[model samples]
Target: MKHGRALTITITLLITVLFAVSAGCTGPVQQPSASPAVTAPAADGSSLVFTDQEFAFELRRTIGASYAGEADIGECLATASRIQEGDFESWYTEWNRTADAFRAAGDGSLAAGHRVSAMEAYYRAATYYRTAEFFLHGNPADPRIVETWSKSRDAFRDAIALDVVPYEIVAIPYENTTLPGYFYTVDDSGISRPLLIVQTGFDGCQEELHPYAMEGIRRGYNVLTFEGPGQGEVIRVQHIPFRADWENVIAPVVDYAAGRPDVDEDRIALWGISLGGYLAPRGAAYEPRITALVADGGTYDVGQNLLQNLQEGGGAPANLTEDDLQEWLQTDPAEFNDAILGAMAHDTGTRWLNENGMFVFSAASPAEFWAKWMEFSLAGIAEEIRCPTLVCAGAADHFDPDGVQAQALYDHLTCERDLMVFSDDYGAGSHCQLGAFAQSFAAKFDWLDDRMGMSG
Candidate 1:
């Protein structure tokens, strides 16, 4: 696999890249609607035939190149592309080459650092594909999209498995079973190291592949990442479902980490995004070992956001009346579970799920979606966190209520916390801020410096 390993040296030699629940407050400029969560519109069947033609041009421009997506992205800019208006073939190609190189660089080599770099590229590629999909251009029910995504998932998993562990105990739980994660440590001889634990958002891998872990580590901390139930690896491989008891599961990881010889237990902080925004505060409620928590691009009510997506999905549920939420819990709970299962099965529909991944629904039907989501919302628990926290939201965040709910969470926290709405100046997208790569980590690293009072 190492020989076939396709790791991108650029991203590692180059880039690295979450936080709070309703630490609701204000951010900078954002997308127009209050909570216009992104959604993948069904592809333009008429124009899709042109995909072949588009691929012709794209293949010529990006083949064997590191920046495949650049071709399609450039076309959009050069021609003033509309929503769902550009080519994906060339874009997807660049994405694959970049990530494959990430893995190829570190694949089973004596140089262990590249292994982490490979995982970073692998993870970024997954995010890049999903982010591009959200803007539109595919058959929501298409099978080819599923095939393409499977390829990306395999690439990321390959990177994850190839790395060596620096820690003695690296456990990743999959329901009842626990698998050990690889370990890593900073070479610097700082006194006690700041222990950084990362909690990823929906469908995220716990390898610091996402931007959050990258940002945290770049700032100088011993960052540990692992997949929890219903997240990246857990769902994809173990098939162990997600449960509401997220904190209980994380407590064990924190406990294991705090006991490590390499870590300074006092500086432990947890950062997450999208749905993890909801899960992190809940986890903090029980495990206070975590000193700082960040709700990146805030979200107060996870369930409410899901409900809004259902309504926007043109499939408003029948039980959406005032007492609808209460009535549904008394009724069937998993009616719409298939909607998610179906979406996860197909890549074309992934953006639909990613845009609205963190919430649950009453049913998959047009009638019961909204009410069901509100039932699962975690808004009521924001008051439990007592750590010095930071809540951030890109002005154009897809989760609109992020600022509002983030402030609410901030007020509820018994500890000191801050809220920052990123300036429009940062063109970082809602959840997958590829553009803010270096800057995001720079901010997080600085934040850690402040908290640790490391100004020697």
Candidate 2:
């Protein structure tokens, strides 16, 4: 089966290359939006605190629900009020301060014998710590970045130790090392139970997966949330660079889960969020043991996005063929680096992308990083997915707006497939349905339950 899938992918790639050269055309790139100011409020009553709307939405979604409402909100508002637009230092300082306060509160609570309060406070502190480290990618070796992340991990460990359900911190052996993860189980029934493997996207960590894992737990499923290469402690501590071949990562993880006595190997499912949309499907294509797959905001060709951004920035030609594009990417790196730096100087989004991309991809220059990102795609491999698959996207997801990638992947899938587009009418039309987690989870777990033979 693997050999057949490989052959299919090779043929598909050949045909795609032929089509690309014959067509001699590429889609026009949309113009880049103006650098908007991160102000307190707009006339519409929306807070313009974060330069990125998606970031703002995600922050709001997690704060009250995942963190302490009063302290986190107050800290957030105060920070936003003073944050200089696109200033990573300012952002880190405020969030880090808030995290410190939360950690102190958790310690006090625990000392007072308020276990539940301590657990909640510790969880909130961990999230705050993660938030602080989000934009500090300019220097991967920065001591503060490592310190903050360590604090986050410690807080999460403390929280889970006091959790109602059993939460086990695990170290799944990979190629030369191990990946960190948390296993959430309702009980030690000794009977095998359905399992869900949760993979976070570009900026997400294992700690942030608690909400999603809890949802799966309530549905009687054991959940494992792990951070692979280029994510969380794996990237920070072990310095494992990101790779496009996610099958290598998932296969090892699946091996670990299959060996566990509590996991029902036949009912194992994989769920990927944000950028994991692309990673999960790519893994499912090669790792055929997975029974079901869910991509929360699907992606088909990651290169298309990079090309679009490049074209919008007037760095690439609209009609550039694949061969021509590849040659162009190999050109003088210094010039490309300068262009990226200039763009980052004015655009907050561009700045974040440049810094984060270089760190995760371990590329010396922006051009190389972009070139590497182009490798992560499901164009030819989507058809190899044999398991029941669910592709989800928000109607207004700026990351994959119009659900183009999800739609494309769904159309190409050879197995039983489902695509659910959360709409703005229900306040779910944001990236990852951030403001509508319940609706998104309902759609995901419902589809998963039916496919996994679980009755609600």
Candidate 3:
């Protein structure tokens, strides 16, 4: 639904990429596994692998959330049994069915004063509702998108209302409006503590970031998570597209947090996931208030990454430099749109990527999307960051299979930095370590603890 990464088109197989948010996983790190070799072509002109890789990956993401109580193993399996393999409508139908059941159960529990049960049901309902809305971006005018997203946000808020720790729905001031957010504090003692600012990437919203906020709270750190322009409420309600200069966003967030009595201005950390990997570092480069930074699945030069993926998949000519690609996009807009849109008709992942990209970035055409993507590069910005940064990379990341983006960011950083390459042996090799939230969060927060001297 939410592809956080570039589309990779293989002969007869398209690898789906989600460059946003964590799902779940549990384990220790180990060496990387050997690449999956493509079997010999059969008489039918297809590889022996007969699977809808995109659907399978999304299913894994759903089931993986069970580890955090965001889903139930049996419930997810039962839902999958009814979903038609690659049919987006079927996927939405089944997930929404389950969400309705869960929401009803939560209502019953709350009516009986069973707060704990109500909390769990509400959380799971939120996740299912979010999943149901994933594939609806293709039609921007779909009413189901807003209805489902609102349900997810409302469910999450209801669940958190029953939590032991303090949680507040906040409105962080921006230029002409306020950004929606959730603020979590370790306690109500009014003591100043380090704050971890968690922001969403391409597809996920602030609600899905609840687990990360809880993790921060457990580690004696306050957490603030919000949806920036082009994400969550900002895009859905305000219709503001994403901006290349992210410092403006982070600076206002920091101002809001610093004004709070519980937040330590000098010990704040900025952690971004998926596309946030690029956005966070981009902001840290200019925002001097961030004491530490984490870019999960670090990205540098997203435009180049997209172009390279297209080139490798035969969607673009080989060795097309940035200048060449720009010239072609401007000179032959019709040809560019035809090539991309034609490919989208047959591939689910590509279609979602293009459609979602256009929706969030507010691009009217594919060529314009590519041009806007070029503005997000961190070529000369990485060196400007002064905070101690942790750049994370999955050994088998679909979008950055070779860890090129992470390496580029890590290599360019002049500040104290660490590059963490998570191996696939631990089930943490996917983009943003979607199925390995536990291992990913443990490693990420551990680094932040050491940097901030919060280690126990």
Number of the top-ranking candidate, with TM-score as the measure: 3
Write the residue-wise lDDT of candidate 1 on 1-456 in tens digits: 121011111212111101212223223223222123222222222232234322222222122112222123343232222323233444445444553444354353416555555554554444434333322223434443445555555554564455332232367543468744434455445446886777765544453343344344545567777767666445445545455657877787787777777788877877766566666767876787978876664556645443344444434453464344335433433433344334334432232343333322213342243333343344556666677776665444433423455555555555676655554343332342334444455554465567665433
What would you estimate as the lDDT of candidate 2?
0.71
Q: Please, what are the lDDT tens digits per residue for candidate 3 over residues 351-387? A: 7777888888888887787677677888899899999
Ten contiguous residues with the weakest lDDT in model 3: 38-47
Could you tell me which residue pairs clash in candidate 2? none
Candidates 1 and 2: which is better by TM-score? 2
TM-scores for all predictions: 0.61, 0.85, 0.88
Q: Which has the better TM-score: candidate 2, or candidate 3?
A: 3
RMSD to the true structure for each prediction, in A, is: 12.5, 9.1, 6.1
Looking at model 1, residue 257 earns an lDDT score of 79
The candidate that wins on lDDT is 3
**Candidate 1 overall lDDT versus native:** 0.47
| Number of colliding residue pairs in each model | 47, 0, 3
Arrange candidates by TM-score, descending.
Answer: 3, 2, 1
> What is the Cα root-mean-square deviation between model 2 and the actual structure?
9.1
